[model samples]
Target: MENDTICAISTPIGTGGISIVRMSGSNALAIAFKIFSSKNVSQESIKPRYFYLGNIHTADVNEKCMMVYFKAPYSYTGEDLVEFQCHGGVLVTQKVLQSLIESGARIAQGGEFTKRAFVNGKLSLDEAEGVIDVINAESESELKASYGLLKGNLHKEVEKLQNIITDILSEINVTFDFPENDDEEVTSADVLEKLTRAQKTLDHIIKTSTTGLKLKTGTKVVIVGKPNVGKSSVMNAMLGTDRAIVTSIQGTTRDVLEETYIYKGVKFNLIDTAGLHDSNDLVESIGINKAKEILKNADIVLFVVDGSQELDNFDKDIIKLLNDKKVIVVVNKCDLKQKINSSILPHAEHMECSALENKGITEIKDKIYNMVIDEKVLSQNVIITNIRHAEALSKSNEIILRVITDLQAGANLELVSLNLQSAWETLGLITGVSGTEEIIANIFSKFCVGK
Candidate 1:
């Protein structure tokens, strides 16, 4: 992927005011000159880092374009780069790109530009991931977290911790040089204290993955219960929009209705499932089966119970079925007064609401927010939100724990040294310093073309 010069339409292919055709590699400027006619600009005559008003002539008509050049080491890929901002008719962009390809620039693979940025040392693996997050971000909180990562907060934190570990390793090495004299003062107590502090830092950062991932990808929450418990209404109330239909008739919703909404900078995938119950009707039974299947993957379940009706065997059976799920029992229609037994029902996270009245909805949102996010993590300056980074951290933690154990057991210094080095190597995987070629390819492949 790295050996070839790459070109692609950097802007969306559509009818607009402008579309950008981007090229990068050692031959970028040469390719730009091949199909472009600009005053005093030749492949060798063009000055680096200059923008020239130009015309991109295909086999037929010419379109006015703005071209910019970046020489090696100063360009996005640390090689040469060129861009043509042309009038954005899908036809015009396609013709211009086709001409450039004919002039010898290869089509860029997905994320090839950003992949080049990663290879050039302008960005780390975390920053590259952040770029994707920023592109995919749907809420203010997700954008903020991803923006922080793009600014290198996560990388800086990990690098700082790595430096500290390196220092500790140096101290351990020093202990071997002075066996009886200087080494004796650097006692087990001192070593244990440093290890304990490092462990605390690692543990705290590891726990942030829970809330961070939720913020990044959004939580999958399913609203489910027996018919007429107002599942759709509750969903509409929470979303503050008429996304799902509300009806007085039983089995009004026969399939899943999904809507996405943002709250407190976090995205929520709100799924309203058909009311669950045994039924003779084939369509309702299919819906019921789908509801059951969705629950298996939901991060949270809002199990609605009718407060206006007496507790029945069907309701009890639904509650029993959801006993192991992360359920927030919602007692709906509080305006009618409570008839359902609050005591005999199994205690879980509970909320009261009248979806029709919009009462207690704010409290429900707050409770849901608190149930999922850790306040301490949100306040912290850094977090690990990527599964790959999280996996590397987990491996690094295990190796660190092994090092600590070896130290405490009075194992040979060589054994302890080996474990500590292994921990350091594991940490390197997060930044791609020691990662495999296959892993790099996999990560970059997630990016969109011309990114």
Candidate 2:
């Protein structure tokens, strides 16, 4: 099955300047030469790693295109590969792919090329996942983290830890063979010291996931306030566009409005819900219910309040709903004579902003970034952005901790070795050294078709 040639439209399926149909495997070059023809190039004379101007012949159409060949062991899949850059159109690209299939190439599955790269040892599982992350990144921060993984930073760290574990296992084996020799025996203190060092490394890596997750999935910022308090205005200012309708009428926004914006390389998913106020209208009441629901799950709540008005029951009710939440008190319309007192909400950070004038918006953005992300994590070369890697590392850490506990308890050497080996194997899963086929399949399945 691995020897079969595979092909797909690598570029997005749409009208563009060019569309690329990619192929890989032992027969990629042979299959490409079967359909491509040019005045100066032939199947027998085509050079590797060079593009040839040609025409791709299909059953229904013939189109001028550029054909490139990559020899095995040098291509993305680490196999013989070819790409046809044809005129960008849905029908043209499909016809090109169809021609390849008809010429004995199979359609590549989602992420098949990258999967082949993984199988061929060109990239580790996490690095392959990082390729997908780069493709799907929504913010600069996400891209930076993904690029770090793609460049093998995490792989190097994991490899280091695995090496330490392998050494410890070897030591344990020696201790097991010469139980009577005090010089060869692996003491509990030695194992503890080594495992403790590994544990510290794991702990720092795990800590980066907090910021990684936020980068992968933007921080959910829910804006809530009483009617006509400029919640929509604040949202517009943050997004630099009018995403929600702004009106003087109370309850104008009866449904949740959501938008995304990037600030300082971080993505913020802003959700503007109906004003939190007493209402008899059925639709408005339903919107209020949804607002409450979204508030409970929000990463940060922008509790917008009209600075021109004193604190009211509506504001008090909304504040109560924010119990124990990471709240940012947004005193909107600060350009007006201040009436709302800031001392009332001491639990949350207060930012005075005039949304109408776009005043203090940058300060609010800075505050949100500081409140959620640690600056140090962003500067680190390796961060765990994928939840799978984080979970695997967490499991490995747990096993190592248990091994440490067992060693401290004076457990048998064999028992400690068993736990240590388990930890080593668990770490291998992140790099695909010991991962199951099902796990590998699931991870690649998340990738876009033709990746």
Candidate 3:
């Protein structure tokens, strides 16, 4: 561990009942003794992991507070650590941190503490990233995926794959070392079989990323259709709130309205766009154009139509755009007599609903949730939410495939082993076992100061 002591406010710097100033390093205990004194424990008698009621005597003020200490090799940073629980006010926490800094503790950079923990072998690279995800998570599903990473399951799986490659490489090397050891003779078929199986396992992981990425970045679901199709009513019904301006008049919503809702633990960005139609008015034209633009980029498009009215040219034009798109034809206003024939819609099963009655709204939500989330992978808890890990896994899988091909072509075992070594190193990028300092620094730089 580094010898320089680092300190920061571990809690949010705002009004609360309590705030913590954390310090970690070899000199943390020495620095704490300079400003904090408790009669219950002396410098030599201070117990590790024991709380001590103390008074922080600074030049500006002598504030009474509580302190706790943790010895090296067992703390969060795997070094000596101390925490001072002070008043929750911003000034109080800042003064406490400044006092520690004046006493020889330097301010911690963003995520230095967790980075040190990684350096000290307390966590893998992916697990450290999980820590960040947990802190910034907005939904239960995001938190669940983050916890999976933090729990080290993904690291363990990668380690197993790496070990398989390592064993194969060792077997290949043994054949080169002892040519007469016929039992050690590794056949190309054997190597190909093992690598192929590993490739399949890795491929499944990458496949889940299609939906896994959505867990981190909420799915973009835009509800669009012609004017007076009850698009705003659908948005309100889905959100269970009067978010968008609901009016019977056509083109009332002359702009895109966006709101977020959690469905079955996954987060979704439900966007209600202006009615898509030919517009002579300038502002409505702008909104219509904007809706068309975003519709091109949406993950899911809810093509709503009024069941009480037949499809018009405006609806046909919008349908032209919905082709080759992931769409749900919402034949809204099912409470009235149904006149719209949903069979004419080319894509997706048309969902009939009355937005005013809130009928079928729950079913629409269920279908939306089911469209993007892969329940099997989420149930297995092996989602690849992090883009970095996904890319690394992909690179490794590609390298392994090339190795399999070279082996099948009767290439020399030495050449095959070299490609396998590359695959191993690539997988190591996710775990930090064989990563460069630049990647590590870049990852940690994104974390908050206290973590």
Evaluated with TM-score, which candidate comes out highest?
A: 2
In order, candidate lDDTs are 0.83, 0.91, 0.91
Residue pairs of candidate 3 with colliding backbone atoms: none
lDDT score, candidate 3, position 92: 85
lDDT of 3: 0.91
What would the TM-score be for candidate 3 when compared with the true structure?
A: 0.95
Tens digits of lDDT, candidate 1, 1-451? 5657899998887899989999999888777888888786777778777778878877864988889888878877777888888898898888888888889988999999989998999788888889988998898878888888889887887786687678777777778777676635355556667867887788888889999888877888889889999999999999999988888988989999889888787788889998887789999999999988998998888889888998777677787777677888889999997897564346578888999999988887887788888878877777777888788888888877777787788776656666777777778787877778888889899998888
Model 3: weakest 10-residue lDDT segment is 341-350
Residue runs of model 2 more than 4 Å from their true location after superposition? 180-182
Worst 10 residues of 2 by lDDT: 340-349
Instruction: Tell me the lDDT of model 2 at 164.
Output: 96
